[model samples]
Target: MGRTILLKMLLFFGIVFAFCTCGKRPVADLPTFHVDVKQRDSASCFFSGYSYVMLETNMECLLTDVDKIKVDSEKIAVLDRERILFYEHDTGRFIGKIDRLGKGHNEYLSIDDFIVRDSLVYVLSAMQHAILVYDVYGHPIKEIQLDAFYKHFDFWDEHRVFLSSDFGNDTYYNFVLFDLRTGTVLRRFDEFSQNESVFFNSFSSFSGRNNKELYVIHPFDYTIYTLTDTVFVPYCRFDFNTEETFDMGKSFAELSDQTRNKSVVKYLGNLIESDSVMYLTFDLFDSHGIGTYLYKRCGQQSYLIRINEDFISDFPYLSSPKGIHGNTLISVLSASTILDIEETYGLSFFRKKGLNKEDNHVIFFHKLE
Candidate 1:
């Protein structure tokens, strides 16, 4: 290895050794919330009503789908594949888009995730091992290259951000606290487990955006950890009320294909958190059962919301949401579906000017009472 690479490896091991005391809690020690998946309710049973904002779809700002969404007080950013499309928060007025999908110094091949910290937009291009920073408009500021491979990331603080790969499939560190300005490794979590293999990597491990806290979860592990200044501490656990159990301590690579295909898998996760509740969407690797549950942040009271009953029936892709405006949660649907909804429910809505459902997507903002 090169001298610089060798030095980084040593630094990583040293950091892991130093922070060993921020230990993982025993499974029995974590607090658990019980969810009754069978007792399901339609979206209307929980939400009083919803309002929508149709994204302006002219020739300039056309998007196929919303891969991910980040909503702030005044702006909304949508990752439509490799491009980041921006829109007004109140009205879906088209803002400019950031399309730097080239093999140049300021370009990236793919965008795994993106976040608006303040005035700047930080786009994560995992395959390029770089995060291209830009102003609110699509103008390029600079690129921060990285040594480690991280598919998803969220800010831990101003100076540091948390980067994580798969839960147990990575050959080296699964999680790292990385410095944004200097590109230094502040800390590394659980280094060198099994061989490198990608498994269940599509899930968004980080949530708790409203509170500015980091809450992360994996598909196989039941525990959720809150990131502190030092290490991750157990925050809560999902008690699915099943009597069956498996080895939560081992890496996913240690398990066979049957175990992986048969086990529980969390899709597009995030464990969406508001001030009062944490929303979880999960499945058992089969079509027979897929459920969503809302658990209280301070208490154990929970309710299961049934998908396929309404609103395109997407568990997390309504579509790929992080738009926390208030008590309101957001989802996406085809604009043409509105006609179907009105006809099926025998209800009428005030249709907008350009309400063509041929290829347009509408944003639904709903509040749970």
Candidate 2:
């Protein structure tokens, strides 16, 4: 009886050890949940509007087109044309711009995307085909030259950078996992879809809540993946419930100017999720408008925020709610749109800031309730 009990204990221990050492499961093995989004023309306000500060502009900080926006511990970093426009954390006072547009070793010609990590700014320059790092106070730190041209990228960790390339000689993977320390290709996954439209629509392609957890969504693929320790596990699959979802992987480059304009109506954009809420947007297939959707996880409820009623009337016109920062849902309103809003609504917020409606922009931050 003692020998039989000993054998059973060893078998149980072995089974437990095997499961613990398995690491990340395959995408096929992980379960995928479907978020039910109710289609609507308008809904109630999800977040309450708090105070907002316009970005101050000067010779060194002349704001042009904002490519991306990130909120750090001490400042707000805005990726303008070829430089990073920094603003004070608590107040929207302009600090300075990092780097510049030049052919020099440290300067970048074209800034594609940027992120703040460990109090350092990593800027990706597609023209230069390199990423330059700068300290918070506008000092050069390091630079890494990529193997190929990439349009957008975000830091996977301190050592690895996840890059998205639309054009390359090889057509195997959609994203390249790059090592920053050695400047070599670590790994690549996400098979490329032979469609040109996927390249043009690639913006806000990668996002995450933290270093350990990051997610990427391909517009042509329409599936979300969570990068685990070992594998890219399938997280959420969206069901548009129609055959016409996403132009059927059609390349927008092949379409005529009229067809391209018509196709923008219903193109799917990015999918961003927080601890409880998920946000996604799509253009109208029939009309010239953009619709934003929100899915509440606790109640499994969905809402299509009315742009005119909930957002535009109170705040200026927004491109889209990009991501959640701290306890707020953040969005960008361009200077041109803010000027139009001021003229149409007779608002004095722009006047009080002494900002030219065509030069500088304002960020709308609403506290999540």
Candidate 3:
């Protein structure tokens, strides 16, 4: 009996170990999730099941805007105006908050972005040129000073980070691989050659999925790249081949604001990935409106499903997904937007969820088909 019990315990631990390492593959070891740019407006698979996480709206956790969100297995961290709020991911229960939003050395004036790793949170303050680290429960750890111009960053590994700079100006290198512990840059890329005519993107999104996977898009270049432990490699390329794509023979000097707005498909980012599928959003010219697509990872073209929400589609209303959990694509929409849809289409989503228009936003977990 003792030998039989010992064998069973070893088997149980082996299963647990396999579950933990399943999603932790070094990125280069993983197969590529393929997508074609011309299929931007193609037919999509109908995603069937979803759930709403109504963020607990109390006096301490009233959210004005959800600028950014990071989710792990248990906790969800949201970056609001000046504070980073925490919530229970499965139940949407409000927990504590990190509100060191003052001028003191320990506090940050603003939160440009935030990254959550293990139980630690790294809040980036662009204006202050520093990153304040804290525990998940709002306790201060330490602050890491930054080199003044990194607009956005995501952890490439435990000791290294991938940093991005502003577009348009001929100032800093477009991207850098920096050593956080050694205070050194190991590599620099895309040094701007043009000095005069400027083109810039106001925001840069360094999309990270569970710290094991990191992806970024070039400001004007239509290629999306993935970062492994050592290098950034091309993951997918967009060739819209339409008149609206910016690089189709248009010179930088001849473009105006109106033309730039119409060419959004050219400057696409917000690239979110999961283990089985990849998702992103892009705008079409004029009345074409916004779009979301779920490109399956197995290299079959037919698996691409355009996540469309007409007034009566069974799928819940969705925008760009902020992150991914397991195989589900996670997105958040304001309760107000749902109230508007309710008001216009005579739907009862808000009423069913016990949500008021002014309540906190709702998070959607879309389990892909």
Candidate 4:
């Protein structure tokens, strides 16, 4: 009986030891790949430009240009001056004007940003601090008013919307999520402060395949946040202030320091997501010139893609760019040019002409090559 009892005790100890050893094993590191491709220019595309100026009380809201217009499939619907124009994506034929608000209404309802999902159009009106929902036929459905000042917004899913507020004197601005059907505040996240400095810029969010995980980007500091279990969590943080990481050499750092003052970093782009990858864009300016970086998030680490100066020099009006068809990058070229290009797998450029002569030139980049 004593021998049998001792054997049982030894077996229990063995099982516990095995469990602890397996549990303590570290997880395998994520894999990474680097691609070296020579830059090449492709085709040209065009888009229309609108100009407007609003006077309210003693303040003036001037819209120097309406750029970065996107198409739902092949149809172009964007505001030009005081008129909202629609065109056939293939033939570039003028379809009709969508919105014809009076000067008073236009001044108050000027579109700050817009997003298209299915048959619904979501436009952000910064002056009103509200979002106007409209159908494809240009009919208003409903509106959502946010308590804080918002700069841009994006749809998380069919029922949820994410809004980004402008960073005031504070280093970071708050991001809020709202329910579209009920217009209820669902969740909010604050920026992580660095040395009492909160990094503020437009934020980017994309969900995984099963929507099990959500990814967010802080454009100012090159930080990436992931939302898990309905809570915002820091997945990885990158410091672009060093050489080993930034790789711009001395010129890049000097330029970053100089432009750090007059240059304002804005998140005027869209987040592109695939089954396994995500991409985002952010603009950085230094005294030398302005530069835009395309940041890619694979599994854990992030990769940087720098926009060449030659491309920017050729197309000066290209600012904030977004994704179309989940793999292409679309942006406005000059005041009148529209650019469409593939951003995933590889990079390519395409351009089209806008409606009028002032809006006739468009340029875009793709990854067809």
Candidate 1 lowest-lDDT run of ten: 313-322
Which residue pairs does candidate 1 place in steric collision?
Answer: 317-320, 318-332
Per-model TM values vs. the true structure: 0.79, 0.75, 0.73, 0.56
The C-alpha lDDT values of all candidates are 0.66, 0.63, 0.66, 0.48
Question: Which parts of model 1 are misplaced by more than 4 Å?
Answer: 1-26, 42-45, 167-171, 199-201, 209-212, 241-263, 272-278, 283-300, 310-327, 350-354
Query: On residues 171-228, what C-alpha lDDT tens digit does candidate 2 reach at each position?
Result: 4565778988899988876676453533443245564444466676654455667764
Model 3 clashing-pair count: 3
Where does model 2 exceed 4 Å of error? Answer: 1-38, 41-45, 136-138, 166-171, 193-198, 209-212, 241-259, 263-270, 289-298, 306-319, 322-327, 334-343, 346-359
lDDT of 3: 0.66
Residue range 1-369, candidate 4, lDDT tens digits: 999999999999999988655423222322223321122222221212322111111112112344435576656655545334555555555554446343444233566567767766777776677777776566677777766556666667778877765333132445678787787778876663422222332233331222454555543333445553255555443333321222232332343454454445533234456666665555555554656556566676455545544444333344445334336555444322222322221323332212332344342434311
lDDT of model 4, residue 290: 55
- Residue 121 of candidate 1: its Cα lDDT? 93
Best by TM-score: 1
What residue runs in model 3 are displaced by over 4 Å at the alpha carbon?
Answer: 1-48, 166-171, 194-213, 247-258, 270-278, 288-309, 343-350
RMSD of 3: 12.2
Estimate, for each residue in 1-369, the C-alpha lDDT of model 3 and write its tens digit.
999999999999999988755534454554443345345332335255788788997888988767767788789888777788999988999988999888986888888778889888988777777778898778999888766556678787788887776443335566777777877778876565543234343246464444455767664556666665555555666544444644343444544353555635545545555554555544444444545545444335434444543443466466656666655667888888888877777789677867787788888877665
Against the correct fold, how does model 3 do in TM-score? 0.73
Cα lDDT of model 1 by residue, 136-196, tens digit: 7789999898885677888888878888775533437767888998988788865555554
